[model samples]
Every structure is written in C-alpha cells, then in structure tokens.
Target: MTTTVTTRTVRYPADGLTMVGHLALPAGTGRRPAVLIGPEGPGLSDAVRERADALAELGYVALAFDINGGRWIADPQEMLARALPLLDDPERMRAIGHAALDVLLAEPRTDPDRIAAVGYGTGGAIGLELGREGYPLRAIGTVNGLVTGRPGEAANIACPVWAGVGSEDPIMPAERRDAFAAEMQAAGVDWRLTVYGGAQHAFHHPTADHEVLPGVAHHPRQAARAWQDVLALLAECLPLGEQAGRAS
Candidate 1:
C-alpha cells in the first residue's frame, strides 16, 4: 500500500447533465482495486472528496462522483426537492452509477475487475441500484441509505452487501430497514446490516457544511465505526494484491 495519494477533478456526462467527479489515485505500480463513492443528498462536497483521498492512501483508486450536476445545495428542503424524484426512480440512479463507473474504469490506475461501491444517503441508493443492475461489484456498502430496490431485483446482486444506519433515524425507520433486509434475504444475497445506537440520520457526515434537516445529525463516534466497517468490508471483499475472483 502506498502512503502517497493523488487526486483530480473529472467531468463526465450523465443523465443529460455534465457531472463532475473527484478521482483519487494511490502512488505505486500496476492497476489497483477501485471504489466508487456516492455523495449524500447535498451532492458532492469536500467531505466526499476527502474520503476518496483516504481510500487512495489505502492503495485503492477511489472516485467520489457528483450528483445534481456540479452544484451543492446546502438547504435541506431544496436538496430534498431535487433528490426526492431521482431517488424514486431506480433506473436514473443506476444510470448515474454506471456513468461514474465508466469514469473510474477509464482511469489507468484502476483495476476494473476489483471494484466496489460505497455510498451515503441518496448516493447509497445509487450504489445499491448498481448492485441490483448486476454490476459485478466485489461488495456494496451503504451508510444511512434506507432506500430499497425493485421487487425481486436484488437477486442480481452478485456481491456481499453491507449497510449501516442510525437506530433513531426517522427517515430510515425500523420498517424501511426491515423491508430492505427482507429484500436482500429473499433474494438470497450475502448481506449484513448494522444499526448505530443513539445516532440519527446522516451520522456519518460530521464534516458536512450544510444545515441538516431535523432528525439528521452527525454522530462522530458512530461515524468512525461505520467507516471502519466499510474498510473491513473492502479488506475482506476487495483485498489488494490478490486477484480475487468475482462475478463476471
């Protein structure tokens, strides 16, 4: 693993809009495992970019892809106004994820076959959509992403899926969490779900610069734990220097 990491801004077209993404690369030889990062409802922010860089430091090429084109809306209501419809449409989310995947794969440093998707909030839903669309991901990890996929479509998920959410998150209440777990279970997918006690929605984004809505607050401790869980998943499913077999 390389300690030095490099990052860059990439622009690509998706869903009739020009999306901007942050790509992070680790310093070393050969192609390396890659991760696609999806930002929360506020769109791509510095927090997401830093995560990509952190992944790069761990020797994985990471791309923090943008939503809402290149804009970042800090107003909670406005953000929801823009994100709600898109969240309801799984195909659109899948298209966005695929576009970002294309960008990640085009990079010379990325190992196309050893790839994973991790997302937060709306971005997490996008990652799940990618899994449901049969993207051959090594694993899928979501934080506070309570959205569920089409009925029976989870059967296409070829990789292990992991999710983290706050126990008190009203947006991702017990009912929704149960439904998501049921979907994965009924599809016979390898999956796990962790509920962070005493935390609220979006607990993983303490670095967010916006005024979050009610029921959404950052819990630094749980956020760190969730991140460690994500790292553990990658280590298990997409370990570096090993050409681990994955669904083709």
Candidate 2:
C-alpha cells in the first residue's frame, strides 16, 4: 500500500518568542508514533524538513522544529552567539524543546506517548535535554551533538540514545567522547556511538549553504550511512505497523 505524506507549517511560542516548526503526517488514519526533530545551530532548513517528510513516509508523525523564531541563521558567528549559550543552559533548551514538543503532541495524528527525539548539531543537544528532563521519549538520536550536560542528569533519560559523529571532529574530540560515554554508562542508559572516519563536523549536511567553517563539511558516504543508522535506531525503538491508529 502506498501512502502520501502531508506537510504543514506550525507556529508556537517558546522562550517568549514564536518558533516555527514543520509537521509531517502520513497518509491514512490511525494514531502514529512521532519523532521530534531539531536542526543545527544555523536553524531550521529544508534538510531537516525533508527528514520529517521522510519519517512521515515511513508512517511516523514527524516535526522539524526551529529554535530562532523560524529564522535560519546565515552567519556562523550569529548562530554561535545564540546557540553556544543555550547549550550550556539545559533548562532553556528544555523550554524550547517543550514548546516544539507541544506542537507535535497537539497534532491529532500523533501518538503522544510513542514519540522519539533526534537532533543534529546544537539541535541534537536540545533533544538530549528533552530526554534528560524526563520527556518519556522512546529513543533519542544525535548526529554531531554529543555535547555533555550537567552532571548526574543522564539518569533522568529513560530511553536508549544513539550518537554519530565524525572521528575528525575537533568540536567533539576524544576526551569529550570519552566523557559522554562515561556519563551514559554511569547513568546506565542504553547508548551507542559511531564515529565516522575521515569526516568532519556536520558531515551529515549535504552542503554549506547556511554557514561555512573550517572542519565543517559534508561526506556523502558517511552522511548516507549515518542516516541509515538513524533509521535503524528508530526502527528498533519506535517501530511502526499494528499501532497505527487514528488519533482519538
């Protein structure tokens, strides 16, 4: 059976500012599992929206959320100015996440309890914060976003986490990776990490349209493989079929 996915723009308030997000719904009727997606520091773009569309095609309600009032940051410095601080404050990130999540949960097509969260770059850290704040997510996936958080908090995360990063990523080097692993291990959460060799930060992105920086480029092969890893994680933790019922 072929299904047609639908896409719509959603606007909601977060941190006293309006956030614009994209929601994608699968064809046919029942309630479906959802994935709350966050984009990199440069803000939401077609890349993340396409991810939502892809998930919807796979029968999952997906939302590609924004952090900067529906705007995409075209400058690296500006993005860093806004994102770097939020990364340090888990509470603020959770607030932004909660608002985006509310948009996803409000949709009649979504199964509120069967949702997962995934983020790329700074967005990835925000999704992890949602899990850390006990959002009841079924799974969490991060690509180049394994940034650490306040200590003793990974224990709050209840679902499995999957993180993928470039082995050559200076932003997230060996020491940081080791620390993240230690944190997850101490919290006893089911976690996994895959470091793609010869790739740099944000390697999943196909181009440098929004911002350009050294050590930040795309790797076609690694990007494709990382996407496959994401799919596998979602499949194992938030499987589709049988549970696809219309929202009540």
Candidate 3:
C-alpha cells in the first residue's frame, strides 16, 4: 500500500544563523528511519525539497537543511563566495548538520537511532563532516562532494560511505578523488566512489530557474543512476527492521 507523505517548514538556530529546513514525514505511527539531506552550494533548492518528500514517501522522515541562512543563490560567483569558506571550516559544517539532525529527531515519528545522511555539492561536504565528528550515521552518501577530511579524522566515520561525481567534473578532479580514496582507505572505512561518465559538476541537480555556470550542467541519465546508487546504499545500511550502532 502507498502511504501519504507530509511536508513542512522547520525553523531552527545554528551557529548564530537562523536556519530554515524542509521536513517531510511519512504517514504512519511510531518511530521510523530518518534521513538528513544537505543541499548544494546554492542552498536548499526545489529539487532538494522534492528529494526530502520522496524519502518521506519511502517511509523515512526526511529533512532538507539550509545553508546560507535560507538564501537560494543563483549567481555562481556568489555561491562560491559563500561556500568556499564554509568548506574549509569543518566545525561550522558540523554545527549546521547537527542542528538539522536535532530537528529531524524532534519529530515523534523519527527513529533517532536509525538515520543516514545524503548530500550534494557543499551540502555533501557537511554530511561528511558530520560523519567525521562522530555522529552515529548508518550511511553517508555524497554527490560532487568527495572532500577529504582533516588528517586522521575520518577514523570517526562509523558507517559505509558512498560518493558519486561526474567523471568530467572540474571541481572534484582526479587528484582530489584519489586523495579522498586514500583518506578513506587509511582510515579503514568502507567507502565507494562512482564517477558518472561524461557528466559535468552537479550533474544530478535538476535544471534550475537560472543559468548554470560552465562545467556545471545536469545529466539526466547519470542523475538517475546516482539516485539509484543512493537508495541501494540506504537499503543495505539502514534497513527498516534493523538498528545500526553509533561510532565508538
């Protein structure tokens, strides 16, 4: 049977910033597995909101959190101006992610112990930072955000990580991807990286209202393939009938 999915806006405070997030809840009683979504550098977009709703329809309480204090940026330069500094500051990323996690857990329908995080671009970096900060996540999925963490910090990641990126993405090039893989390997974490052939940066993002920058176009075929990979990761790691443990 198909269950109803409900969505709402949630306002919260994080690191002196008033964050606004989209919360999606599945129609059911008691606790259910939850997902935390991090939007790209452009902040929370309609596509990200829709992803949350889709997760809810699949019986996962979902929250697509804000970055940039609720501003959805369209200018590429403006987005880089806001995102570059935050990417360098892992603590700030963790602050925003944890704040969103708190709101997700506050929902009576959410199963606090069973949660995963999926993010894109700048948001994907935040999700990885949360994993590095020792958050108890069953799985971490990222697209175009294969950012390597601080030296030795990835040891804190307690769950498998699945990352996807466009093979032609200039932002996360071959050197950067190799570095990320090295980090994960050294930390003994189970991680996988999928490179979508001939795609550009942010290929998974749906077409936006404004024009995208060079090397940042959407690839529909690869986007669909990436989503399926994420769903597979979630199913394997956060199965509805089982509870996973936190990092030690």
Highest TM-score: which candidate? Answer: 2
C-alpha lDDT score of every prediction, in listed order: 0.90, 0.89, 0.89
lDDT of 1 by residue, 24-137 (tens): 998766688999999999899888899999999988899999998999988888999989999999989999999999999999888888899999999999999999999899
* Residue runs of model 3 more than 4 Å from their true location after superposition: 208-210, 243-248
Give the Cα RMSD of candidate 2. 1.8
Best prediction by lDDT: 1
lDDT of 1 at 13: 98
lDDT of 1: 0.90
TM-score of 2: 0.96
> Which pairs of residues have clashing backbones in candidate 1?
none
Query: By TM-score, is 1 or 2 better?
Result: 2
**Candidate 2 per-residue lDDT over residues 18-82, each given as its tens digit:** 89899999987778999998999889999899989999988999999999998988787898899
Give a tens-digit lDDT track for model 3, residues 1-248: 66798889999998688888999988767678899999999889899999999888887889999997788888889989889998999998999899998898899888888899999998889999999999999999999999998999999999999999999898899999999999999999999999999888989887832267877888889999999998899889987656324211
lDDT of 2 at 243: 82
